[model samples]
Target: MSKVVMYVSGFCPYCAMAEKLLRARGVAEIEKIRIDLQPEQRAEMMQRTGQRTVPQIYIGQTHVGGYDDLSKLDRQGELAKLLEDL
Candidate 1:
């Protein structure tokens, strides 16, 4: 399985949902970077993804965007492929 990293805040519903979905898809571990706790990480996330949003996800080195984008990938049957690409 590929490494999954998510930039999230404490009170983000979409972050929780994204975690749940990834878990359901057999992702055993998610490396969650809590931007709420470390404010500097938010800047890093924005620099890395070029967006200011919670739940900026990455599957391996590929930026997966947010929960909606993740769901779209799953719905299109490409998420499994991405996850297996490690």
Candidate 2:
């Protein structure tokens, strides 16, 4: 499996849901970067994605966007191929 990295806050439901979906898809060992815990990470996330969203996801080096974007990719059958490439 490829690496799953997510920038999330502690109180985001969308982040939790995204994580659950990834886990369900057999993505173990998710590397979570808590924006709330480290203020610098928030800036990093924003710099990377140009968005201050709570759930900024990255599957390997691919920027998977937020929770809804991630789910959309999965529903559209693009996620598996992306992961396979990763």
Candidate 3:
């Protein structure tokens, strides 16, 4: 499986939902960077993704944005293809 990275904060419902969706998609491991614990990581996430929201997700090196974006990809049937090479 591809590497899944998510920049998240504590008590984020979107982050939890994102994790559950990814897990259901056969993602065994998710590298969760808790920006709430390390404030500097929030800046890193914004710089990387150009967003200030929690649950910024990446599948492999491809930025998948947030949980909504991930779900959109899944609905479009592109998510499985993205994971195929992993």
Separately for all candidates shown, the number of backbone clashes (residues 3 or more apart, or on different chains) is 0, 0, 0
lDDT tens digits by residue: candidate 1, 1-86: 23999999999999999999999999998999999999999999999999999899999999999999999999999999999995
Error of 3 at 4 (Å): 0.6
TM-scores for all predictions: 0.96, 0.93, 0.95
Q: Candidate 2's residue-wise lDDT over 4-65, tens digit each?
A: 89999999999999999888887878889999999999998899999988799899888999
Residue 59 in model 3: lDDT: 88
Off by over 4 Å in 1: none
User: Which scores better on TM-score, 2 or 3?
Assistant: 3
Scored by CA lDDT, what does every candidate get? 0.95, 0.89, 0.92
Best by lDDT: 1
Q: Which candidate is the best by TM-score?
A: 1
Predicted candidate 3 versus true structure: per-residue lDDT over 1-86, tens digit per residue: 33889999999999999999988988898999999999999999999999999899988899999999999999999999887766
The lDDT ranking, best first, is 1, 3, 2
Q: How far is candidate 3 from the true structure (C-alpha RMSD, Å)?
A: 1.7
- Give the residue spans of candidate 3 off by over 4 A: none
lDDT of residue 82 for candidate 2: 73
